[model samples]
Target: MAGVLHRAALRTSRLLQCSKRPSRYHNGSLFFSTSSRRPLMALTGFTETQLTVRDAVSQVCSQFPNTYWQEHDENERDPTDFHATLAKDGWLGIALPEALGGSGLGISEATMMMQAIAESGAGMAGAQSIHANVYATQPLAKFGTAEQLESTIPNIISGRCRVCFGVTEPNSGLDTLRLATAASKQPDGSYRVTGQKIWITCAQVAAKMILLARTTPLEDVEKPSEGLSLFCIDLDRSKHSGLDMRRIKKMGGRAVDANEVFFDNYAIPADSLIGEEGQGFKIILHGMNAERCLLAGEALGLGYAALARATQYAQERTVFQRPIGMNQGIAHPLAEAYMRLEAAKLATYHAARLYDDGSVPAADVGVACNSAKYLAAEAAFAACERAVLTHGGMGYAVEYDVERYFRESLVPRIAPISREMILNYISEKVLGLPRSY
Candidate 1:
């Protein structure tokens, strides 16, 4: 298995190198060469297996049209049917181990699945509706004991269970080490948790929660990051009577719910603990690089979809005797957006390759992941804005569909991690500067 993965990684690298060279064929046609100079296929950095997964996902996405997404957007309804279809098709477990009823694919395949979904014009709403199942329990897969893994992973992989992450807090913000959410040990070996969490996605529909809480006071711990623990607790709304869930109104991605969650002395069984005591922060950080890479791919897909729409509109719309694409003002921005999207896509794929190959250290992967995500978010936003501008008045009109992309593109820039936070990461970690925040 390791050998196969390495060969795939090598092929992916070569494909990326080939893609960077200028294409010899004109008019957007792929050219072949007799002497090892053929132009690389676009999006070719993905391995053959990855490509197969992408094609399969694309095939599924093709069944849903722009009209379908438009209706869903207008109604602010969940894509329960779509989610069920994916679950039935075994897509929800794309990254889980095969023994647990999943295909045991890596992040590359999962990223491609998300990218395909967004590129189909469904945007973040489509991806987020099914994203949590893809990799939300990676820590459990990697760190949980055999018995724990047997109990937790299969239910999630099979879509029989839904889990929401609880990391961000209202007061703590990104300063995770300073979180005040306390989980005190009880006489019965369980823990009583008390805290409030903000901006938790999909909480309203989740049956379980991957929670992080302070197990020891900051002053008593050797480091602020220590004394933190993770729990895969059952969100038994009845037993935890103090637990409160309130949905938040959001600018976009309305199909996937987001909420503020409050916990008041919620009791979680001792068996729910994910790993060794006082190690929640480390476990949570383990998934950050993968999360960033996935987000970058999703953002790249949105940019591609927006650019495709703009290009189509430009070619079809006529003014003053010719297609509007004949004008440089309208055409140049779309072209530039395409180039930016390509650049971001390449960065994201490269980061994924490095991660999969283990060629880069875990900490360095964070830098690469942040770079890819920041670039992709910026590129996607630019492409969506240009798409709307290209459509002129029709863009703002909900009927045109560009406005939906414009609204949805704003999400990748603001959530999970923000542009400012990425900048701070690069400054402090990459450049060895003092922490800004």
Candidate 2:
């Protein structure tokens, strides 16, 4: 397995370098020289597999300019065309199984795809437009009935259907085991679900959902993690009798919509249930580690993008008739940003490898995932800050594009998981200290 992985990585690297070399026939330079050259070498030290994935994604993303992303963000519209293009090209299903109509690639490839998207100047807006569809179906893929998986996976892979995750709630926050949503089994063997979910990414546009609700009362269940059930249900907006979705306006990633979803006696077929009833929590937990690692990859990309932009601007912008990059004050921060991002990138790829191998224990992957996410988030934040400082007043301006990366960088630090929770995981899980929360 290790040999196979190594070979895969090497092949991917060769393909990446081949794909990314600029065409000599082009009339004009495709990108600013400094920023264009920086990402190639800066990210090359990571796994060849990751670099290959990044290069492929970057090649595809280069078609969409910064102006395209800015327009999408300004209009607060999802980049449906961009997403459909990816879906058509089979990029959206890069991590899914080949039998299920995906490219049959692994999470490592998917992370590189996302990272490259963000690094190409699309930022979170471009990435999140298709993020949920990339990996949110893991529960169904892994634990759903064969019939269920067959019915659902292909449509999602084809981009004919969209799914959103329903996990976080207003009351419970990150204490996922304490969620209050309830699903009662009726005489006809259907589930009547009633609950509210917050921060459901892309819910407003989703046609389906991977939902979790308590099937058995917490007190009645022996384990707190038991009694919770996972479901893959229809989010039929026209049948508004039971489901209500209120779009939440967010500070960044505006091109993709997030929402607060309320379910009141939403009727779903018993077959909609994923895996075993009362095992929903465990099923969902199966994907959380991968999600964190992927987010780290995304953060790593954003950090590299910011650092590349800052370094380029410093080289071109004049100060006292000299390039600002000539001074240590500006040069040192860019170097620091590079170091931090590289460190986080290493952790993210290591976590990805563990996940792909399945040899490491689950607890170990969880800790590593959290560590990657925390480090990547911090690194991305620092890089964006430095980018802003390096660009001076122009960074604050929208046309320069640094501010967009800066704002979008904050989402990864705050969402999916927070830095505080990541530290708590490390302190308790890695050090064997008492739980902090």
Per-residue lDDT for 256-333 in model 2, tens only?
A: 898999999989999999988998888897778778877887887778777777876887899899999999999998
Please provide TM-scores, in order, for all candidate models, with all chains considered together: 0.89, 0.92
Clashing pairs in 2: none
lDDT per residue, candidate 1, 300-406, as tens digits? 87887777777767877988989998899998998898889889888888777776666678778888888998999999999999999999988998777788889
Best TM-score among the predictions, by candidate number = 2
Off by over 4 Å in 1: 1-41
Query: Which residue pairs in candidate 1 have backbone atoms (N, alpha carbon, C) closer than 3 angstroms, thus clashing?
Result: none
The whole-model C-alpha lDDT of candidate 1 against the native structure comes to: 0.78
Worst 10 contiguous positions by lDDT, candidate 1: 25-34
lDDT of each: 0.78, 0.80
